[model samples]
Each structure stands twice: as structure tokens, then as C-alpha cells.
Target: MSDTTVTSSSIRNLIKANIRNYSMVLMLALIMIIFSFLTDGVNLNSRNFTNIFMQNSYILLLAVGMVLVIIVGNIDLSVGSVAAFIGAISAMLYNSGANMFVTILLSIILGVLIGAFQGAWIAYAKIPAFIVTLAAQLLFRGLTYIITNVSPISLRDDNFKQIASGMANINVLTINGVYYTALVAGVVVFLIYVVLEIQGRRNKIKYGFKVSPMSFFIIKLLVIGLLIFGLSQRFATYRGIPIVVIVLGVTIIFFSFITNNTVIGRYIYAVGGNARSAKLSGINSELVVFVVQLIMGGLTGLAGVVFTGYMNSALPQAGNNFELDAIAACFIGGASASGGIGTVIGAIVGGLVMAAINNGMSLMNIQAQWQYVVKALVLLLAVFYDIYTRRKTGLG
Candidate 1:
């Protein structure tokens, strides 16, 4: 009877733990379902579903970076302003008859320059990141107004626009007698995951750490297979996945590797979890912050390119209030404000949730005021759940 009691208690604990971990994802699905019915099933079309990623790619980019910044116990209020500045620069270069290649290179360089400048202020001069980035937000936004004269710069560069507009359908595959591009892409993705898993396990064993549980490994593979297949099917009958989706997927994998596999990543987590202790342990906290910001700036530049290309224009006000969306996405993804906790996967999930909210409400033809109200309420609920879960786990 004691053993039975133990099993029951353990099962209950597992249920609670899972509920806490996956509540946001569950909420996202719930919203999707509610909006699907509300829109008479018009909200989940293959094309419209893919459009969500194209439209919100920049938000995903910014939120990924912001998660790192927030994980390190810092804030960057300047990203929106930086994006606006770079968008103007990109527009100017394209208008000057510069090639798309040159324009992209210049914009990324300028963004890195801005990040280095901010890092110098915060890391070397010892200014608080909040103050430095806040000031930067104002200054860069002001600069954007000056650069573009508050006018919209419509892009006429075909190659540049194609970067955000094109889709990679791969080739069609006969799957159970149905010709499907999703099936093709799904197979490729699953093979890639399998190869990667083997390589990762080999590396772990090479380093002498215990390999992850075989059951866990298989579970991860299954989950990835399902996700890739699901998303591929959703967009299969359309134009396949957008190039922007490819970009977002690469960013997710890249950052996930950074956060999980590198010393810089470890130091980032340490500094965020406890700065003074990390310092005493010989971690260069400031350098970590600087490098992270540098990377953030570069990603912002990339996001700007995609954003402008998708719109076929760059406006001085293109990124208005975008920082809010990015920050909200990060926090909603289970990132702790206190630092040292966040995952690339979580950030993606968070960004998708917000995008779903926007897209679904629009599909339902909800009033603008009600949309805003509903989004605000969802944001509040996500944050509250995060707080409650953390406290319940004694991590708050």
C-alpha cells in the first residue's frame, strides 16, 4: 500500500509539473481553436498560417535576442529604434542603386557598430544597461527621423524583396498515394534531426559526460518529427515554407546551440543567475553582455532586412512599438525577469503565440480596441502564470 501511495503521489507531481511547463503552449492551441471556430475555420488555411511566420519573423528575431539579454539580467530598449535606423539605411542604399548584397552588408555593419558603441558604454563605462539602451532608443529613433525625414521609403529592389518573399517547396513526394511537398520536407527534416542527435550524443560521450537517457532521446526525436510534419502539412498545399520561415528556423537552431553548447553561453547563464558569484568564479560578465548585445544588434539588422523586404518598403516608423512585442514575447515564453532562464524553443513558442493572437483576431474581424484588450489580458495572464509556477517550484 505504501508503494501504491508513492506511485500516486509521483503521478500527481508529474501532472502538475507538466501543466506548469506547457501551460503557455496549451493556451496558444486553445486560442487557435477558439479563433478557428469563431472565424468559421477560415483562420487556419495553409496560406494564412504560413503568412503568420512571414509577418512576424522580425518579432521572432527580436524576441530571441531579447531573451538572451533578459537572461543576462539586462534590458535593451533600443532594438526597436535600432531596427528603424537600419531599415532607413537599407532603404537609402537600395535607393542609391546599390546592389542588394551591398545594402545588406552595410546595414548589418552599421547595426554591429551601434551595438559595440552601446556595449562600450555599458560594459566599460559601467553604466546600467537599462539607462544606456533607453538613451539609445531615443537617440536612434531621433536619428531615424532625421535620416528618412519621417517618410516611408518603398523598396523597388526585386532581389532584396525575394529574400523575404520566396518559398522553398523542395520537390513533391508520393506519400501514401498523395503527392505532397510537405511529405518531402518532412522526411528531410526528420533525417537531419536523426543525424544531429547521433552527432550530439557522440560529442557528449567524447567529453565523458553521461549520455542523455535513451528514452528521452527517442522522445525528442518523436516530438521533432511531429512538429516538422505538422507545420509542413499546414503549408504544403500552398507555396511550401517561406524563405523567412527558413531564416527563423536557422536562428532558432543556432541560438539553441549557443545557449546549450558553448562556454560563452554557460557564462551567460551564470552571470544572469548570480552575477557577483560568477565574477568571483572568473567569468567575464561584462564581456558576455557585450558579445550578447553585439549578436543582438546583428540579428536585429537581419530582421530589419526581412521586415522591409516583406513589406517592400522601409518606413521611419516601421518598428514602432515593436520592442513591446518582442519583450512581451520573451517574458511570455517563460523567461525569468531575474535572469538565467530561457530557451530558444520557448522564445519561438512565445512569438508564435502572440502572432496567433494577432492573426486569429483579425480573421475573426474583431474590433481593434477589443483586439488590444484581449492581447493585453493574455499577456497579463501569461506573466501571472509564470510567476505562480516559479514560486510554486521555489525558483521565484
Candidate 2:
């Protein structure tokens, strides 16, 4: 082939490959566009944009842990109940002595214990995860009521409340009568891309597999650019990006890296892909499940702190129905039901998809019932597409 013709063909291939790789992201963008039109741009406001992210952080946190659980061919239906139970305990401690530090530490410890108990049943006892967690849902939820007696508790600690409300200004940027924190975020993202690229290359070489070309890297960088620019503009008119955004950003990077780069992450994936095969391959499936549950419990504890601090109060049902949201987020993020399939970026985007729908509908003053209907349709369609694509590609 002529050099020019060869170059043209390679470019087209790169473009096609990227679109296939990020098909979910494109769908999310389309949804955003539709919402922007319906809301008359209200949903895209810098302040509202920041609000969407902050409001969804708890679900995002849970979804991260849930992704691991689902990847290992199990589900934890108890996280919502567990989170509420812990919050209830925290409230009791607060209501009793108002010792924020002590209460927080106790709650985290409680989370570890709860998670380990459930993990032991599912892993060591050979009980199905769904059943163990379902029982936990009932048990912990009952404890939540017993601990608080159905009374909502208010947090009185000023510093505790500020943990989720405060913003750091060092990264802030003022532009065109607005402020932006993404300039710093942009730098961090670029560095992350470089690190990921180096690691991917190293891994491909280590495994002696063919590495993707620079064109692939270019596409990845371009997507990152779009993300930073779009999100930054959404926050440029506000005071700056909120601290919650930073927290979520860090969480995304850490989890994404851990899952993509670490040995633990691969074991999780292997266990999900095939537990029996993974075990025969010398992977400690038992340890993997245990650690997954351990991390999940810790994350739930963290989410409780965030939700309480953000609201400046802990309700009797502080984490009501959050497990459902996390599950939906994972499924909608393109994870397979049969397990061993998901990405951190996909999981984060899935949360954004939910937030976008919520924010957009609220902006348009749509009734809550209709919002549910619309979201249900979106979720169903995403799953249907996932199954269809996998079958079409013979991935099954």
C-alpha cells in the first residue's frame, strides 16, 4: 500500500477502536446533551455541576466497592444496611458524649467487624454471598432501629461537619468572572495518564504480548482532555470545584490504579472470571474474597462519614437504599452479570450517568415518579445493550 493510504487506514482504525472502547462514554455524553436541552442549561451550571458530583459521592463510593464484589461473582446486599447501622452507632456516640473522634473510630472498627463476619460466611463457610449479605441486611437494619429507636440524630461537631463541606483553594482558578480547580486537576490527570501508559507498556512487555501503538495512547489522552475540559467548564463559573470533587477524583484514581495495576486487582478479576479455574491456578480465592469484603466495609464506613458531614446530620435511615444505587451503577457501567468484567472509569461514568439523570430531571421539575420511570428505562437498555454486544462479538 502507498504510504499515504496506509497512514489513512491506520488513522481510521484508531478512531474506530476508540469509539468501540468508549462506547459507554459516548452514550453518557448523548444523555448529557439531551438533559442540557431539556433543563434549558440549568443542569450544566458550574454550581449545579458541582452539586451533582457531591450529591452522588456516597453512591460512587459504594459502587467502587460493589464493583469488586460483583467482579468476584458475588454481591453484598448488606452495604446499605451496614452503612446505616454504623451511622446509627455514630449518632448514639455523638448523642451520648459528643466525642467526634471516638465515635468515628468506633464506627470504622464496627465496619471492619461487620464486613469480616459476612466475608467469613461467604468465603470460609462456603455460603452463597447473596444469602449471607441478605441476612446481614435484615440483621443490621434491625440493629439500626434498636440502637436509635427510630429517632433521627443531629451531629453537633463543627469540625466533623466541615469535613465534607470545606473546599481547598490552592487549586482554584479564576477565569472570565468565574473560578476553576481543574487546572490543577488537569496536571494531575496528565501525570496519571503518563503513569498508566508506562505501566501498560511494562505489563505488555512483561507478559510478552503485543503492546498497543502510540495511536491508542493518543486516543486515551484525547478522551482525558475532553473530560477535564468539559468538567472544568461546568465548574468554571462557580467559586471553584468543591472539595468533594477532589475526594471523588482521588478515589477514582486510586481504585482505577489498584484494579488495573496491582496483583490484588488481577486476582479479583481472575476470581470473577472463573473461581474454580482461578483456584486451580494457585490464586487464593478465599483470601481474595475476604480482602474484597474488607475493603468494602472500610469504604462503607467512609461513605457514612461523608454523608453525615455533608448533611450535617445523621438520620435513622442515613444510607437507605444506597446498596441498590451502587448495584445499578455497576451494572450500568458495563459490567457483566456473569462477572470478571468492569473498569474503574466505567464505574465512575455509571455514577455520573445516574447523577446526570437525577440532576437533569430535577432541573426540569419532572415529578419524582417520572424520574424513576426514566431511570429504569435507561438501566434496562444499558443491560440489554451489554448482553447484545457481548453475544455479537462471541465474548460469551
Candidate 3:
């Protein structure tokens, strides 16, 4: 074959191999377009779209951790209950006139302790995570009720509430009545993303690995950059970028870096890929599992803080079904049910897909029952796709 033909084949194969990496994002965009049309523009309203981010902040946080848990071939059914328990503690502290900082600190420390306890059983004692976390789900839920007396505790601290509802504290500029902070941030991020993409392609080519054609790479970057810019413009017209958006963005970036660049991250993937082999290779699979659970607990604590702030209260039912949403997001975002195959970015896309569906259906006046049915169907399809891909790749 000619050199041109070989290059073309490499690009084609690269696209096929990584199709799932971008599929969920495409689905999310398609869902947004469809809902925009169906809702007569209501679903795409700047406020409504931004609300999706704010509303799903906790689920997104849970998703960041849940993907790691699922990738490790384990589950965390206790996250929602842990969130509720933490929220209750925060509320109790705030109501008792404690400083907001102290309340948050204590809540997170308690969450870490809870994680350590559960991790010990699942990791060291050889208990199944499903059973352990299920027990913890009931245990922490009961504790939430005990703490809150099966009632809601209202929040009165403005600072505490701001974690979920506040906008960025500073604005760079305003042009033609548009806040420029988000737009500027969007541009900066786009530049960084483009640089990284180009660098990745170069590295792949240098290593003789297959890579998408330059044309395809450019197109993908353009679409993604435009999406970010457009979303920022929309938010610019409303409130400045939200504080929760910053939190979520930071979480995604930080975790992405951890999983992609760090030795600990490689160990995690190794453990998930094969615990026995990983242990033999000195990867410390149990330690990875334990640390993952600990991180999940920390994220759950943060979610509790955000959840409480969003509602301005902590109640018995505050975190009901949250763990389910998080897990579904992971599965829908292209995570393998078996383990060792997922991405931080994919989890975010999956969370947004779920959030978009919920927001769009509400805008269309769809009944709650139908919303559940729709989500169930979508999740089923995603898992089926994962299984199909695994089988095709001989991983199943």
C-alpha cells in the first residue's frame, strides 16, 4: 500500500477504536437539540440550561467518584445515605450557631471516617462491596433520620447557602451588556484544550500509534470549542458563571489529571483490569480499593454540602435515590459494568445527559412516571452498548 493509504487506514482504525469515547457527548448534544425543538426553545433557555448544571451538581460530584468505584469493579450504594448523613450533620452544626467552615470540615472528616470503616470491611475483610454498602445504605439512612428526627432542618447562613447558588465573585468585563468573565474563561479553556489535543496527536504519531486524521481532529476541536463558547455566552447574559460550575469543573479537571498522569491512577486501572494479576505485580489492589472508597466518601461529603446548599435545608429525604442517579450516569457515560474502562470526561457527559433529560422532560410537562421510564430505557441501551463493545473487543 502507498504511504497515503496507510495513513488513511490508521486514521480510520483510530476513529473506530475510540468511538465510544465521544459517543455519549454526541448523544448529549443531539438530546439538547431535540429537546430545544420540542420545548419551543424552553429547554434551551439560558436560565433553564444553567439550572441543569446547578441542579445536577451533586449527581455530577457523585458521578466523579462513582465512575472510579464502578471502574474498580465495585459499587457504592451508601453514597446517598452518606450524603444525607453529612447534610444532617452540617445542618445541625449551622443551626447550633457553628461557623460554616467548621461545619464543612467536620462533615468531610466524618465522611472520610465512614469511608475508612466501610473500606476496611470490603477491602481487608473480603466482604462484597455490594452487601457492605447496602448495609451502610440502611445504616447511614437510619442515622440521618435519628439526627434530624425525621424532619427538615432549615439553613439560615448565607455563606453556607452560597456554595450551591452563588455566582463567581468577580467579572472581568461587560461588553454590550454581556458579562465577559465566562466568555473569557471559555476562550482560555478552548486554547488549552486545543493545545493538548494537538500535543496528543503529535505524541501518538511519534510513537507510531494510530491517530485520527488531522481533519477529523480539527473538526472535533472546533465543535467542542464552539459548544463551550456558546454555553459561556448564554451564561454571560444571565448570572455570571456559577460557583457550582467552578466546583464541578475543578473536580473534573483534577480527577482527569489524576487518572491520566499519576502512578496511583495506573495502579487503579491495573487493579480493575485484574486484581490477581495486579496484586502479583505489586499494585496493592486492596489499597487502591480502599483509597477509592475514601475518595468516594469525600466526594459524597462535598455533594452533601452542595445538596444542602441547593435546597437551603437538610431533610430526611434529601438524598433519596442519589446513588442510583450517579451509578446510572456512569453506565450511561460508557463505563464497563465489569471494570477498568471509563473516563472522567465520559462520566461528566453521562451526568449531563441524565440532567438534560430530566430538565427537558419537565419543560415539556412530561409526567414523572414517564420520565423514569425514559431514563430507564436510555440507561438500558447504554449498558447494552457497553456489553456489545466488550464482547467485540474480546474483553467479555
Candidate 4:
């Protein structure tokens, strides 16, 4: 074949190989477009855009941890209960005149201990994670109710509430009712993304690995940059970026680094890919499982705090079905059912997809039951796609 033909063929193969990674992005965009038309553009409004992030912040946090748990070939069915239990404790502490910082710290510590307890059983005792966490789902949920006496504990602390509901007020620059801080942050993020993409491409080339065509690479960067700026503009038109968004962004960055660049990350994939092989390779699979659970517990605690702050109270049903949402996000975001494959970015995107569906349906006045049906279908299809792709790639 001619050089042009060869280049075109390579591009096609590249796209085909990576379609799974970008499919969720396209799906999210398609869903947003359809919802925008159905809601008469209300779904695309700045206010509603901000609301989606605020409403789904806790689930997104849970998904971050859930993806890790799933990546290690384990599942956490008790995150919802753990979150509620921790939120209840935080509320009680605040009510008893504890400082906000202390309340948050103690709540997270309690969560970590809870995780350690469960992790010990699954990792050291070789108990099935599903069964252990299933029992924990019942255990912590009951504890949540008993501690709160089946009543909601109100959070009177405005500062604590602000964790989920507040906005940054960096008045460094504002013009025409727009916050320039958000825009500046957006530009910085876009620049960092561009730099990283270029560096990654260069490194791949250096390592003699095939890279996408330069034109395709540039286009990818452009699209991502547009998205970054577009979201920032939306937040700028509102009340600046929400504090929860900042928190989520930091968490995403921190975990992304750990997963992408750390040794523990490889251990996780190794254990999930083949426990026996990983153990033979001296990977200490049990330790990896234990650490993964510990991290999940910490994130669940943070989610509990955020959810409580958002509601300004610790309701008895504070985190009902939260585990389902987080797990669904992971599956939809491209996590393999058998584990050893997933990304923090994928989890975030998966979460955004879920958030969009719920928000869109609510905007259209759809019933909650139908929303659940749609989510269930979406999740099923996502897993089906994963299986189909794995088989086609000879990995299944």
C-alpha cells in the first residue's frame, strides 16, 4: 500500500483499539445533547450544570474508591452504610460542641478503622469480600440508626455545611458578572493536560511504541482543552467553582497519580489479574487488598462528610443506595467485571454519565422508578460491552 494508505490504515486501527476509552465520552455528550433538547436547553444552563456536580459529588467520591476496590478484584457493598454511620458520628460530635475539624478528623479515623476491620477478614482470613461487605452493609446501617435513634441529626455548623454547598470567592478578578478565577484555573488545567499529552506521546515514541498520528493527537488535545474551558466558563458564569468540585478535582489528581505512577498501582492490577501469579511474584497480594480497602474506607468517610454537609443533617437514609451508584459508575466507566482494568478518569466520566441521567430525568419530571430502570439498563449494557470487547481482544 502507498504511504497515505498505510497512515490511514494505522489511524483506523488506533481508533478501533481505543474506542472503549472514548465511548463513554461520546455517550455522555450524546446524552447531554438529547437532554438539552428535551429540557428546552435547561439541562445545559450554567445553574443546572453546577447542580449536577454538587448533587453527585458524594457519589463521585465513592466511585473513586469503588473503582480501586473493583480494580483489586473486590467489591464494597457497605460504603453507603459506612458513610451514613460516619455522618451520624460527625453530627453527634458537632452537636456535642466539638470543633468542625475535630469532627471531620474523628469521623475519618472511625471510617479507616471500620475499613481495617473488614480488610483484615478479607485479606488475612481469606474470606470472600462480597460476603464480608454484605454483612457490613447490614451492620453499619443498623449502627447508623441506633446511634441516631432513627432520627436525623441536624448539622448546625455553617462552616461544615459549606464543604459541599459553598463556592470559592477569590475576588482576584471579575468582569461582567463572570469570575475570572475559574477561567484562569481552566486555562492552567488545559495547559497542564496539553503538556502531559505531548510528553506521553514523546515518551511512547522514544520507547519505540506506536503513537497516533500527530493530527489525531493535536485534535484530542484541542477537544479536551475545549471541554476544560467550557466547564470553567459554566462555573464562572455562576458563583465561581464549587468547593466540592475543588475537592473532587484534588481527589481525582491524587488517586490518578497513585494508580498511574505508583508501584502499589501495579500490585493492584497484578493481584486482580492473577492472584496466584502475583503471590508467586512476591507481590504480597493480601497486603495490597488490605491497603485498597483502607483507602476505600477513607474515601467513604470523606463522602459521608460531604453528603452530610450538603443536606445540613445526617438523615437516617443519608447514604441509601450509594454503593449501587458507585459500583454502577465503575462498571459503566470501563471497569472490567473480572478486574485488572479501570481508571480514575473513567470513574469520573462514568459518574458524570450517571449524574447527567438523573439530573436530566428530574428536569423532565420523570419518575424515580423509571430513572432506576434506565440506570440499571445502562449499567447492564456497559458490562455487556466490556465483555464483548474483552472477547474480541482475546482477553475474556
Off by over 4 Å in 1: 1-20, 169-182, 194-220
Candidate 2 residue-wise lDDT, 1-396, digit = tens? 699898787776555434424787887899788988887877767788778877888889889888888889999999988888787667667767857678777777778888899999999999999999999999988887887778877766666665466665654466676665665666667777777878888988899965557777776777777788777766665656666677777878898889988999999999999999999999999999998998888778777877877777767677777988888888888887789988777777887888888888888889999988988888898778777767765667
User: What TM-score would each prediction reach against the true structure?
Assistant: 0.89, 0.90, 0.95, 0.96
User: Which clashing pairs does model 3 show?
Assistant: none
TM-score of 1: 0.89
Across 325-370, the per-residue lDDT of candidate 1 in tens digits comes to: 8888888888887898877777778888989989988876789899
Name the lDDT value of residue 345 in candidate 3: 85
What TM-score does model 2 achieve against the real structure? 0.90
Q: What tens digits encode model 3's per-residue C-alpha lDDT throughout 132-194? A: 999999999999999889999887767777889888786658777678898998998788778
lDDT of 1: 0.82
Off by over 4 Å in 3: 1-5, 195-210
Backbone collisions counted per model: 0, 0, 0, 0
Which lDDT tens digits does candidate 4 get at residues 320-381? 99999999999999999898888888999999999999999999999999999999999999
Q: Which residue pairs in model 4 clash with each other?
A: none
Q: Model 3: how far is 326 from its true place, Å?
A: 0.3
Question: Using lDDT as the measure, which candidate wins?
Answer: 4
Off by over 4 Å in 2: 1-21, 94-106, 169-182
